[model samples]
Target: MSRTVTLALVDSAGTPLGALPSFGVPEPWWQEVGSIVDGARRRYGVEVSVLRLLTADRAAPPGGCVSYLAEVGAPPRVPLAPVTVDLAPQPRRAPWAQPGGPARSLAWAKRELDRLGRPVTGVNQQRSWNLSAIWRLDGPQGSAWLKQVPAFFRHEAAVLRWLATATPDLAPTLLAADDTGRILLDHIPGDDRYAADQAERAAIAADQHTVQRRAIGDADALVAAGVPDLRGPTLARWIRDRLAGHDTSVVADLLADLDARMDRVRACGLPDTLVHGDLHPGNVRGDGRSRTIIDWGDAFVGHPAFDILELTEGLDEIDTAPLVAAWAARWRAERPDSDPERAVDLLRPVAALRLAAVYAMFLANIEPSEHPYHRDDVPACLERAAGLA
Candidate 1:
C-alpha cells in the first residue's frame, strides 16, 4: 500500500494548530520524516513549528518550506515572533541523536558571543549536517555575523579567522573565536554573482589566489606547530570509498582516470599553499562595484594550481578559457618566477577531483534526479571536468 505523511503545527500545549495536506511516500520514509519533525518540535518546545513535510513523489512548496510562526499555544500576549529556519536533509546521520538537546555547537557560539560581549538579536539554523547557525549580533557599535562551528567545521573557522587577521581589508574582520569553534565576524552584505565582466571576475580571482597563498602559509605553520592536517589522505580515502558505492560505470571510469591524473599532478609538487577547498562562483559576491568571498568552511592546505581548477570547474556554459588565461596572466604578473604551464597542468586534476566530490556529495544529500547537476546545463561541467582529466 502507498504510504502517506501528515504535516502539522502544534502549540506549546501540544494542541494541533494546523494540519497540512498529507503527502504520499514509501511507508518507511514517511514514518522517518514524521518522526524527525515531531522530535524537533518536542525538543524545541512551543517555539518550534513544523514548516514542511517532504514526500517521495512531490516536491515541497517553496512558500511552505519552513515555518516562521511560533507554536500556537504560547502566551496570548507574547508578540508573534517570527524566525527563519532552513531544513535541508543532513549530509549524513550523526552518530548520536540528542532530541531536544542543546546543539553542541550552539554552546560554543553563545560562549563566543559572551566573550565578545555582543548581544544576539537573531539566530537561524541552517539546514546542514554540522549544526551550523547564522546569528545576528549587536556589535560594539553595529551588527556582525556570529557563526557556530561544530567539530567538523573547525578547520574552516580557523582558516577564515586566520585570513581575517592576515588580510584585514580582504576578509571580514574577525571579532572573536573560541575553543568550541564558534566564530564572530563582521557582517558584509552583497549578492552572489556568477557571471561578471572579464575585469571584475579576474580581480576577484586574483584576490582569491592571494588569500589562498596566505592560507597555505598558515597551514604549513600549523602543521609545524603539530596541528593535524585536516585534508590529508583520510579525506581523499573517504571520497574514494563513497564514490565506490555509485553505479555510474561510465562516470566511475572517468573518475578513476581523473584520480590517476590528480596523483601525478600532486607528485609534481607545485607550490603548496592554503586553498579555498571549494571555490565555486556561488561563493563569490558583489559585482564590479564590490566583491567578497564568503563561506570558508572548505579551506584546506593544498596546491594553488588545484585551487584554481576548482574555481573554474563550475562554469559549464561560459567558456573558462578566457578566465583561465586571465588567471594565468595575473599569476605570472604577481610572481614572475612561477611557471604558468605547470600550474595549469596541476590545477586540471584538482578541478576534476572537486567536481567528482561535489557531484557525489549532492547525489548523496539530494535525490539524484532533483539535483542541480542533473540539469542540462550542468552536463557541460561534467564534460569540462572530463576534458581537464
Candidate 2:
C-alpha cells in the first residue's frame, strides 16, 4: 500500500506556518518518520523533524494520508502559500514528542559525545514512537545511537548496562545513560540479520544460550537492576491479572487452563533466566565475522524457551529445526535433567499469552494517537495462542 503525508509545519521557535501540500512517500508505517523528514527536505527544501502524528485518513495505522506536526529548522528556501493548519502543542504527549523534547535529547547527546571526544558531525532521526525514539549520530570516530524510552521502559539502559559487563560483545556497547531513559550507545557495525541462513541463525541462538546460562545465577541481580522478574509463577500471576474481565471465548479458554499450563512448562525443569523478551533475526546485527544483538527494551528475566520461540517467530516457511535443536542442546548440556524440548513444546501458548500481555502493557502506557500502531496486537496474540492450544 502507498502512503501520502502532509506536514503541519512549525518553525524552530514553535510558530505555526500552515500545512504543506500533500506528498507521497514510499514507506507506509506512520511511526517511521525518517522518510517523511527526508521527503520534506528533498521536495520542499525544508529540513524538518516530525514531532507527532496529527491526523490520519487510514482505516488502520501504518498507511494512507497521514498528517504530522513537524518542527522545521528554518523558513523554507522556496516559499509558497499553503492551507492554514492548527499547530497547537498537544497535551499528554510522549517525552520525545513534547515541545523541545527532541532538542533537549539532542543537546544532551552532543555534550556526552563532546565529553567523550567524539564530536558529532551529523544527526538523523531513525525512528520515533511512544515506546522509544532513536537517532543516529555520525562523527569522525564512527556512528553512535541516541535512544530514549518511556518511563515504563526505563530499565532498558540497566539491562544493557548489565549486558555490557556480562557479555560485552553480545550486545551494543552502552556509552552513557541516565535515569530518565536516555542512553548513548556505540553503534554495531553490520547489517540487520533479517535474512540470516539457518546455520547462522543456529549459531546465533547458541551464542545467546551461553549468555542465558551465565545469567542463571545472576537472575536476582538482573531483577535488582530493574529487569522485570517474569519467572513461571510471577508470569502466570501477571497474565491472570491482565486477562481478568476479558470476555472473548478464546481468552476464556486460555484463562481456564493457564495455571495448569504454566505448571507443565515449569515441570520441564528448565530454570528461569534472562530472556531477550523479543528475539528475532531482525534484532540481530552482524557481518560474517561477528554478531551483535540490539534492542533490549523488551529484555526481562524469564524462561529461556521464550527466546527460542521468539527467534523463529513469523518465519513459518523457513526450517527452524536446526535452530531449535541447537538451542535445546545447549540447555540439555547445561542441565541434563531438564526437558528443554518439552519446555519449548509446553510454552507455546504461554509465549503467546506473554506477548499479548506485553502489547497490553504498551497500549496502557502510550498516548491514544499512537495506539493504532499496536491496538490489534493483544487480540491478535490471543487468537494466535488459542490456535496453538
Best by lDDT: 2
Cα deviation at 246, candidate 2, in Å, is 4.8
Q: For every candidate structure, what is the RMSD over all alpha carbons to the true structure, in angstroms?
A: 8.5, 2.1
Instruction: Give the alpha-carbon lDDT of every model.
Output: 0.51, 0.83
Highest TM-score against the true fold, candidate: 2
- Tell me how far the alpha carbon of residue 48 in candidate 1 is from the true structure, in angstroms, after superposition: 4.4
Q: After TM-score superposition, what is the CA distance of residue 117 in candidate 2 from its true location, in Å?
A: 0.4
Q: What is the clash count of model 2? A: 0
Which regions of candidate 2 fall more than 4 Å away from where they truly are?
12-15, 75-92, 244-248
Error of 1 at 129 (Å): 6.7
lDDT of 2: 0.83
Stretches > 4 Å off in candidate 1: 1-7, 10-111, 121-131, 138-140, 149-151, 178-181, 222-238, 252-260, 266-269, 286-290, 314-319, 333-339, 342-350, 358-388
Residue 254 in model 1: lDDT: 54
